[model samples]
Target: MSYNDRFIRACRGERTDRVPVWYMRQAGRYDPEYRKIKEKYSLLDICRNPELAAEVTMMPVRKLGVDAAILYSDIMNPVMSLGVKFDIVPNVGPVVEEPIRTKRDIERLRPIDVEGDLPHILETIRILDRELDVPLITFAGAPFTIASYLIEGRPSRRYLRTKSLMYGEPELWQLLMDKLGDMVVTYARAHVAAGGKAFQLFDSWVGALSPRDFERCVLPVIRRIFDELADLDIPKIYFPGVSSGELLPSLKGIKADVIGLDWRVPIREGRRRLGGGYAVQGNLDPAVLTGPMAVIEEQAADIIDQGLEQPGFVFNLGHGLFPEASLDKIAALTEFIHRYSARQLQNGAAAKEAERA
Candidate 1:
């Protein structure tokens, strides 16, 4: 009932009554209400209306009672400011109208004009800040991930064109990463200024690179984005997307508050790889939600237990929610994480007190 900062506290590695929970794509088609709204208005259409966008963003907060509310927006939303035209095609994902291939195309990208081009987005953040009980996480796609879409022109499985450019045209690749990094730095500043309580940089496709290639190609840009935002006091998160376990050890001083783990690595192990400098979030397999309720609780408890072993941890899916994921199951899972972790924490505190006595 009261304003809950459990999510925020966890991000800062503070102890709480329980492990806070929020899914990656929490406000999605899985909810019957969201589906009904989608029938009336497209995802982009909903985003253009600030009041409606804010309401859609809060749907899961009211329904499943998540600890944080991520802004309901496409990562591509900011690219329009860079003069790229794209569409979020139904069932396919983001599709670029004109793919960037040449050096001139990369140079053509302008610094993002957030207030001028995406006023509705900032307005939505303002509305959510005034209304929500939970922290709002405004996000931007990391340079590599955004570059993947912009280069490939659509949802890609192999990213052949993207990698060809990265490996073949190294100088050209740096130029693109630089501009995209600049856009993220500028865009994120605007979100925080507009009242976003926290920020996440979604590098959802960066895991595609080998550790050597990622470090050589993308890590500099990643480092710069977080470094530029170091003045923002809110928690910052870096989700390196699926299969990113191998990429963790290289993130030594990226300045993010949390490093999101895919289910490929256990929470404790992921922290070890990250060298324990930052708080950790996620690694729960989102697919486990489609299984039996018992399976869901067991898996969630395992993650929560490992999370409770440390001070800074948040409960969340390893990745985005599936469209067919059950809403009832998600709501039940949230309650389980809250109730079970709270009891576990209380028991541990009592044991410590007894020892002191």
Candidate 2:
């Protein structure tokens, strides 16, 4: 089967010819070709330009032969579309203006007009779906992550504003979450309608909340987004970052088809926690790609081995590619996983059969 078909099947908890591989932020700053494109267009420009976005999205697939292509965009795009002002600073990540402070601030936030600010994202998806050979996945910021930005106003080491609202003003926090949940569902559904085959909800800051806080304040909203997208037939991937291992079980009620594991959680442990039915993606440390090819191969091999224990698995780095990662090493890892992991699986299965005989 083709890589895209294999990936889609695996995400649905079905067997595939081999483990499918892709990367978070696969179409970003690592590739020289991507850099050349960026010189002519800014990060926001490329995301807003369909042709440029499509070109960037296809670069990794062409260079590394990845199984899927994520739409070239950021977590804050939807927030920007919702009338919040923001800018992306080089190395510094996103900076948001007017942090939500009161019930009045939450009430003032507008609904996203998917047709208005995000038309280019839809156009890019249409272009990729037509031209690219792999499955095109699009993403949105999960409610709490978006809320974190809206509350804290930027990337924060301590999510003080977010927790203050959650713990101190419980009713207002729930109200904000309720509103953002509705927006996430609408945004994800729009991508599916525009030809995106898969959707990922990036809960990048949800780890800041305790398991109790997450279950009380965040889990229901995440579940609602996934449940709303359940009818779309596209797999939904929920990726909660660092120290989020405990949050895995809370995902049980959410209707997501895939669970994305970060490097902090081992793939075997994540599989054990998430159980056998759902497809799992990632857990490889993205930093390993910066090391020697041998080390990269060793880490990739281990992740793939653990992934095979599950019914469906898609190989990936735990998070977005670092700007300085070696593209050649990434290519080598992809080819190695595509080639050797299947053989390893075959040899193991044959040994089991011999033992049974």
Candidate 3:
């Protein structure tokens, strides 16, 4: 099967020729060619340039042979289009000008004009569909992650503003979350319409909340977003970061087709907790790519082995690729998945056939 078909099938809990491998942030800083392109254009600038974004998006697929090409854009792009002032700092992540601290602040936020602020993203997806041979996985921040930045106005080690509001001003927080969920559904549907084959919702900060807080404040909004997109028939990958095992049970009622496991959660444990109904993606440490080739190979093999126990698995790093990650290691890791994963699948199938015989 082709990579696109294999990936979509994997997401749907259907049998495929092999486990498909792709990477989070596979199109960015790890590749030297991407770095060169970034020098000529800012991250946001390139994201808004359909030609340039498409070129960067296809780089990792061409170089590392990943099964999917994620669109070259940051999660904050849609948030910015929602009337928030933001900037992507050099080493730092996103910084927003004002956080929504009160009910008035939440009410002040406007709905995003998907066509106006993100026309280039649509154009880039169009180009990618035409030029790339693999699946195109577009992404958006889950309501909680986007709300974290909007509430904190920047990356925070403590996420104090976010929690304070969640606890102190429950009504306001709910309103804000509801608005963000609406934005996610709108943005995601637009991406699907623009030719993206699948979507991944990055709830990068959900682990920051306690299980009670997560259930009360986060899951409902996430469910609404996924529920809204139910008719799209595209695979929805939900990635909740850092020790998110506690949140998995709450996801059972959500509409996501795939649950993305971060490095902190073991894939086996994740599958067990999440049950057998949905596909699971990731759980490999991105830091492993910075280690020796042998170490990377061993770790990659271990992750693939764990993933095989599940019906649907997509090979990926737990999080985005680090800027300092070794490109050679990534290339080796990709090739390893393509070769070793396929062999393992073939062996498993043969064993099953023999057992039946």
lDDT agreement with native, every candidate: 0.94, 0.85, 0.86
Q: How does model 2 fare in lDDT?
A: 0.85
Q: Where is the poorest 10-residue window by lDDT in model 1?
A: 1-10
lDDT of 2 by residue, 184-230 (tens): 88888889998998999998878888889899888888877777788
- Scored by lDDT, the top model is 1
- Which digits, one per residue and each the tens of the lDDT, describe model 3 over residues 34-134? 88887888899998889989998888888887788899999999877778889898888898878778787889888989999779889999998898788
Off by over 4 Å in 2: 1-3, 352-357
- For model 2, state the Cα shift of residue 105 in Å: 1.2
What digit string (tens of lDDT, one per residue) describes model 1 on residues 1-357?
478999999999999999898999999989889999999998899999999999999999999989999998989999999999988999999999999999989988988999999999999999999999999999999999999999999989899999999999999999999999999999999999998999999999999999999999999999999999999999999999998999999998899999999999999899899888798999789889899999999999999999999899999989999988999999999999999999999999999999999
Backbone clash count for every predicted candidate, in the order shown: 0, 0, 0
The residue pairs that clash in candidate 1, if any, are: none
Evaluated with TM-score, which candidate comes out highest?
Answer: 1
lDDT of 1: 0.94
TM-scores across all candidates?
A: 0.99, 0.96, 0.97
RMSD, every candidate, angstroms: 0.8, 1.6, 1.5
TM-score ranking of the models: 1, 3, 2
